[model samples]
Structures are given as C-alpha cells and as structure tokens.
Target: MAHSRGKRRLRTLVRNGWISDQHGAWPMVILPAFVGAQLAHRGSIAATADTLAVIDPVLATSLPITWLTGFLCFTAIERWALTPKKRRPSCLPAIITWGTIATTTGLITVIRSPMLLLWTPVFLPLFVAALWEVLHRRPRSPLARLTTVTAASLMLPVFALGVVGAPSPLRTTPELWRATAILGSYFVGTVPFVRSMIRARSDHRWEHASVLWHLTSAVLILLATIWGAVSWPIGVLWVIIACRAWAFPRWQRAHGPVKPIIIGMLEIVLSIVLSALIILA
Candidate 1:
C-alpha cells in the first residue's frame, strides 16, 4: 500500500509538472502561429507559384516546430518557477528538464535563422514586464495579461518570417502589423471579457467595460475595412465577437453561472472561425 501510494503521488507530480492548468492560454499561443503560417503560405503563392515548391520540406516544418517546442518548454519552466518556495523543491526536476529543452531548441532555432535575433528589442521589454508580474504575483493583473497577449500576438510575425523565407525587419511591412493588431485586439478584449465572467462577475462595471471594449474593437475593425486596411470578412468576424461579448454576460446573469468548459468551447469555435476568416480574407 505504501509503495502504491508513492507511485500515484509521483505520477500526479509529473503530470502536474508537464501539463498546464491555464487552458485559455493555449489558444493565445497557438492561433497566432497558425494564422501566421497560413498568411505566409498565401504570401508565397502570391509572390511566386513555385516558391513553396522549391523550399525544403524539412526546413519548412522544423523551424516552427522547434520554435514552438522551445517556447512551450520555457513557459513550463516559468510556471514551475512561480510555485511557492516550499513547493519549488518538488518542481526542480520539471524545471531542469524543461529548461534544458528550451535552451537547446532555442539555440538551434536562433542559429538557423540569425535574423530572428532582431526581435530581441521587441520582446525584451515584454519579457521584463512579464517577469515583474510573476515576481509580484500579479499575473492576472490587466497590464500583465495584456503584456502576455501582446507577446503571443507578435509570434504571428515570427512564424511569418520562418514561412515566408525572408529576414526582413518586422517593421518593413504594414500588413504584418495590421494583422497583429487585428489578432491582438481580439485577445486583449478577451482579458476583460473573461474577468467579467469569472473574477469580477459581481462587478457590473467589468461587464460594462467589456461590452464597451468589444464594441470599440468592432467599430475599429469596421473603420479599418472602410479604409481598405483589411477585408470585410474580418470586420464581420469582429462584429460577431462583439455580439458574443455583449450577449453572453447577460445570459449568465439571468441563467446563473455557466460551466467554464462551455465558455472555453465557445471561444475555441470563435477562434477557429476568426483564423479561417483571416486566412481566407
């Protein structure tokens, strides 16, 4: 019985060490990268039909995979590092394993594409802010959450750089920034929308603020469409997101608390739709 209990406890620790409980964060990390890859594929086709045809399949596949692995490892290490001091000793194995993987993969990626280092200036401050939040135990603060969302959104350009087979500075193209803005706006708006539902559910002000933010996002996207900055499809998607933001809280207020899984599923569907529209448009 003692041996069986010990085995179970070890299994639980290992599982908790490897898997993240922050389910909402996965989409933020993944969707931007997916959008970037699709956009790059599209850009390559537009630039030259033979562009992708000539590129090495291994290279095209490996860069993003390696980068993503390194990124996930880093995040896992960060999560472990943030554990309470008394619990941190138990997290040591996870931290060391993830840290090693993160370092090795990160080095390989940077060596393969040295130009990626150019993003240092962009990411450094955000990293600092994120670290500050972690140290201060304010990871859920609006500023901290926005900082994280912004960092994730910027990965779109990073993935684009890998797929488009170019090393140009991220600022060279307006389209990259524009797409980042569209994606970032949705994620930033999510911070408040989620807070209104869970953490600040009793605060009417959060609901109002969330509605206002979504409406503003929808209007801004509409204006961008009118200005020919983005296509109408993206504008329509923003409007749909805005409606979701407005309607869901009222439903929750009347019906009582909704299951988090249902909320997560709805966001997943919306994220898929958003990614598809962005790519198609």
Candidate 2:
C-alpha cells in the first residue's frame, strides 16, 4: 500500500514539472498558511488595535497574503535545489558547518559579549536549511528532526522561566545567570541530540540537509533565547537570517561558499548595527 502511494505521488510530481530527485524540485508557492498566520498575527492586530481600538479589517485582509508569500518562497527554494537520498551530495560538510554554527552561537550566548549580537542574523539560514533536510522529500527519519525541535522548544520556555523569575528591574543584580543556564542547557542538550540525529539519518540528501539545518537552528535558538532572557533583542535578525534558507542552492556547491558565507556575515553585521542603534537610542 505504501509503495503504491509513493509511486503515485512520484508520478504526480514528475508530471507537474518536479524533478525525480529534488527535495522540493518543483516550483510551488507553498502556503504554510498556519505558521505564516502565526508570524503576522500579533504585530498586525496590535498595530490595528492601537489605532481604532479594535481589529483593523485591512490588517486581517493582509494576513493570509503574507502567509502565502512566505510559504511560496520556501517552496520555490525546495523545488529547485533539494532531492532525495539517491542523488544526495555530501551531507557531512553541511552538517558539520551548521553544527559549528550552533555550538558557536550557544557559546556566544553563554559567555555573551556584544560580539554575540553580531552573530544573531546567521541563525535563520542555518536553521531553515537544516529543517529542509527533514521537511523535504527524503527517507530520513522525521522523528529525529521532530525530537530536536521538541527538546529545543522546551528549553526556550525553561530559559524564559528563569528570566521571568529574575529579580525585579529595580535591583542591581543583573540577570546574567539566565544566560548562563539557558545557553549552557541549549549547548549541552543540542550536541548529543544532533549527533544522535545525524547518526540516524539514512545518508539521503534531504536527511543530511535536515541534520545540518536543525543544528544551525539549534544554535540560533540559543542566541535568540539569550537575547530574550538576558540581552538586547538583536536576535530578531537571527530569525530573518534563518528564513533565508528557503533560498538555498539545489546542491551544496563545492566551489567557494563565498555567497552564503558573505550573506551570513552581512546578517550578523546588520544585527550589530541594529543593536548599537538601540543601545545608543
């Protein structure tokens, strides 16, 4: 039964301009409507409420469009660059790179200085690419990706608790401990889990990508938590960077990683600038 369904789905995709082996090989305006809705919900309604003391019809009207565009962007990236296990490139390099990013982000947040703020934007691409590994078409165990996301999500809330429980703003004791605990936990928990997930990946292209992508996101998550729990809100840039994963090339290029690396650095710089301005203001 499963074999037949797989065959059917493959046929449908191939007929519709999808490549035989790409992850999201067909161009689609993917509508991850739910997640998209969540992203715009709070901001739009809040903006509207502050004006008319109620929900603005204009804001509500734009919500679905915002979600559709974002989803389609991701879909386009997937269809172009990714494929299944049979045609995968080297997953090790990508996975290792993302892992390093995660570890570094975790380290920065824990032993945080202003430099950590510079790294906030790179978090997004790292994260989204890794997730594409899992979410894209491949035989990798989605369970592994699910595990990483679930555990990490739980840690974010835990860190928030520590922050919320901190001394009142009137007090002199700065809330550095929140950073220490959350970043530490984020680092420690992520390493073992990512290692385990990578081991479990079936050497498929998408699986390998997912492993790398998740590791990157895990690091970004650490940065985001630190900003949320202990420092300035420069982590918002991290979210933007992660979203850039939807623009990844169809395969990991063996040539210079010039473009991606440069983009990543640019994001970090943007975060630094934003942070500096906020602090100065």
Candidate 3:
C-alpha cells in the first residue's frame, strides 16, 4: 500500500508538470540569477561572498519558487486558456507554489527590497499572456512574443536589485542598465530564431529570416564594440551566435538536432557562455 501511494504521488507530480519534462526551462531563472550576481559582484570573488552571506537563504528559497511559478503558470494556462472545457486545477501544486511565492516575496520584503516584490505584479500578467500564447498554439503571435520577451527581459533588473541588496533607483548604476539591455536582447532575440526553427523548419524564407535577424544583431554588436559601448569579447560572442543562427538551418536539414530539446540545450549553452563572457569582459 505504501508503494502504491508513492506511485500515486509521483503521478500527481507529473500531472502538475513538476517532474515530467526537461526542456531547459530552469535556465530562464538561472541565467539571470547568474548574470545578476556576477554583475553585482563585478567579477570580484570577495564581493560575491559578502553579498552571498546575506542573500544565501533568499536565493535558496527563491530558486524553487521561481521554477514553480513558471511550471504552475504554464500548466494553468495550458489547461484553461484556449480550451472550451475548463480543466480542474492542480490544487496541491497550486497551493504549494503560491505559498512559496508568498513566503519568498515576504522574505524579500523583510530585506527591504520593495522593487523585488514589485516584480510579482509585473511578471504574473506577462507569464499568463505568454502561456496563453503557448496554449493557443500561436507561437508566432505578436502578443505572445511581446509578453514572453518582456518577461524574460525583466529578469536582468530584478536580478540586479536582488544582488545589490538595496532598493536603489534604476539609474544608480549604469552598468546594470546596460547589462539589462544586453541580457534582455539575448532573451527576446531567441523568440524569432526559435519560432522559425520550429514553425518553419527547413523553409527557406524562415531560414533567411533567422539568418538576417542574427546578422543584424552581429552588426549591432560590432557597432557597440567599435563605439566602446561593450568589450571586444562581447562582439566576438555575438558573432559566434550569429554564425550559429546562420548555419543551424542547413545543419538541421541534414543532421537533425531533430528534437526541440536538443536545440534548447544548444541555446542554453550559448546563453551561459555569453553571460560568462559578459562578466569576464
């Protein structure tokens, strides 16, 4: 009976989208957290340690909350949005996740970071809208793209504030703002290339669209490098990304990364490397 009960519990977790898949979703939180922390530390190990001394618990508590937020939000959208029949809510997962969000947000409040709490309201609606797009099977919809990109973009500022340990105004640090733009662009830019990859596959027009978008990005990075707006390393990194976008379709047509998950992993690696290079630069 105990064994059977454990199986039942596992089934519940899977049904709620907590334990079923591995599509690199967690990186959505991780990349921003890493970049934010790294930027906050400014590549100084001592600074990172000092900040971590106070924020360690908060980070530990928040990681799962962030993941659960994405999981439950997406699950709710998948079941409710675009369906004629309303599916029953995953009550256990919903309760646990909402409770965690509340607890973590409250902890941030105790730390006196109001801006962090502010993210809750802004992100909730965006997540809903993004998930709605996903559920409606409209990956290329403007509304979908806008909401998802906006949500992903916000990660930079939110993470910066989290690492800084204070509720300073946006302008207090120019680097964080620049980091926000660079990281946000990286997040939002994925939408077109990825949508093209899945929705258009080997279609020449879509392939060309992806290639053009990436090349344009590379050119912008080159300009930024020339202007000394960013380090030369970033320009090189952007070129690498542009090359991937340029060559990926042809590779896919022949070799088959075949699975969306595989493509997602590639993107994750690039994002991590880009974030690392930004920090090093």
User: What C-alpha lDDT, on a 0 to 100 scale, does residue 26 get in candidate 2?
Assistant: 15
How well does candidate 3 score on lDDT at residue 90? Answer: 51
Residues 18-47 of candidate 1: C-alpha lDDT, one tens digit per residue: 655577888888899888777776663223
Question: Residue 192 CA error for candidate 1 (Å)?
Answer: 0.5
User: Could you tell me every candidate's TM-score relative to the true structure?
Assistant: 0.84, 0.25, 0.73
**What is the C-alpha lDDT profile of model 2 across 1-281, one tens digit per residue?**
99999999876554332323322211111211221222222222122232212223433333333323333333333433344445433333333443444454444333422332332354355445445664555323454334333323322222222112211212212232233233233323333333332343233454345446645754765575675643444344334433433233222233323343354354345434533422332
Runs in model 3 lying further than 4 Å from the true structure = 1-12, 19-22, 43-87, 90-92, 95-111, 117-128, 131-142, 202-205, 254-257
What overall lDDT, based on C-alpha atoms, would model 3 receive against the true structure?
A: 0.64
Q: How accurate is candidate 2 locally (lDDT)?
A: 0.35
Q: Which pairs clash in the backbone of model 3?
A: none
Winner by lDDT between candidate 2 and candidate 1: 1
Give a tens-digit lDDT track for model 3, residues 167-204: 44333455666666676677666766776678678567
lDDT of 3 at 26: 55
lDDT of each: 0.75, 0.35, 0.64
Q: Count the backbone clashes (under 3 Å) in each candidate.
A: 0, 17, 0
